[model samples]
Target: MAFFGFKDFDRLSEVDLNIYRFFTANVDKVPYLRVRDIAREAHVSNSSVMRFIHKLGYDSFPEFKVSFRAEQQQAHPTNHQINFVTDQNFPTDIYEKIELVADRMQQADQVIFCAMGSSGALAEYAARQAAAVGFNAICVKDPFYPLVNQLKNTSDNLLIALSVSGKTIELLELLNNFINNEDVTLVAITAEPSSQVALMSRYVLGYSVPQQRIAKYYDLTTQVPALYLTEQLISTARRLAVQAGDHLI
Candidate 1:
């Protein structure tokens, strides 16, 4: 069995704790960040930051970052949860769900997939699927700005958002801006059934997962299950389009 102890982290001083928090929060934004950046952000000297990393069991700053990312990846493996699909299941429900996703695709002339952090990968995957079917599909990295621009003069378009918590500030802000816009359709896929995203979207698809018991742990169950659902939706859309003699590129 493998385990990690937080006693060392708990022993850190206030300044070190602040530095660690900064590193964790900005790691995704600055994956290859420099030690000087961390020191500057933490208001500490480079030497002190190096000492801190060493005390945290890292040989160097880069080594510390690598270990930190590895720890995160291990904590949230790509396939963290299992999805069961039995042959005995009814095809009508599956077909209905597929038709719902397919109908959304057929109605939209353009599509934008938006998400951040780990969920961004799912958004990108959805975008690619739509593009393959000859839809004007684009993946917007900066959610707020792109969404605001698109909503101003909305087309036959749809915004598909993938968010695990559904409370991300950027996404929430975008959703709030579009709440009164009837020209655009908003679809949200989230793990939280009662999340603000679920409540605000015109169409909400929930991905249920068992809650984690541990604190401060990355739970792939929160976001990864959506991958399966997204894939199913995309496949169904494509197959339906092909059946209708609508040659998608």
Candidate 2:
């Protein structure tokens, strides 16, 4: 409730606004982040982050976070409502898609996790978890330069693209690069099954969350579904590998 108020943030500079947006979008993770971490994620200077905190009438980042967490803790218990993607009754096809994605992940030689913005952070985390279970995985935040350079010659790779809308331009362009490549498989964890990314993906694990929009741009769509999908894929793949006598550890 405290973080959602925009009166003060609306009066700030553009850089501060971007920082506010990032903080708001990722408010759930703020309790674990430092001032420098927020600055880096918001693409701003540490001084700017301090100034932004001061603008909210906090003398220091720790004090500000204490209040932020207090406010969240106060509201979170009541806010633990049903999640459409995780708690609601989904159709049979939803589970089927997850199984198919798990099958593809188990068979792939390597895994590439792709996303943009906050989702890229998630992709990196999923990649790390997959690698821990012995799957060769890497996170590609940008599909342009570094990713293209690293994965140019690789084939038999599984791409797990996470986008709530499934319409990110850069991600789609990257997916299209291997649209006809039989050696690469695309698995989409998205909110919209009809989105370009989902349509092009070989398997789609979609969620049923109400798309949140501000000024005709999607802003607040939760990614719990993507996280769920990644965890499921990792667990399913791990179990299958063990059953097949493939030493995952």
Specify the highest-TM-score model's number: 2
Task: Give residue 36's lDDT in candidate 1 (0 to 100).
Answer: 88
Candidate 2 Cα misplacement greater than 4 A, ranges: 1-89, 146-149, 215-218
Best by lDDT: 2
Models 1 onward score TM values of: 0.58, 0.64
* Model 2 clash tally, residue pairs: 0
Q: Model 1, 45: alpha-carbon shift in Å? A: 43
lDDT of 1 at 107: 66
Model 1 accuracy (lDDT, Cα): 0.70
lDDT against the true structure, each candidate:
0.70, 0.81
Question: What TM-score does candidate 1 reach?
Answer: 0.58
Query: When superposed on Cα atoms, how far off is each prediction in RMSD?
Result: 12.6, 13.4
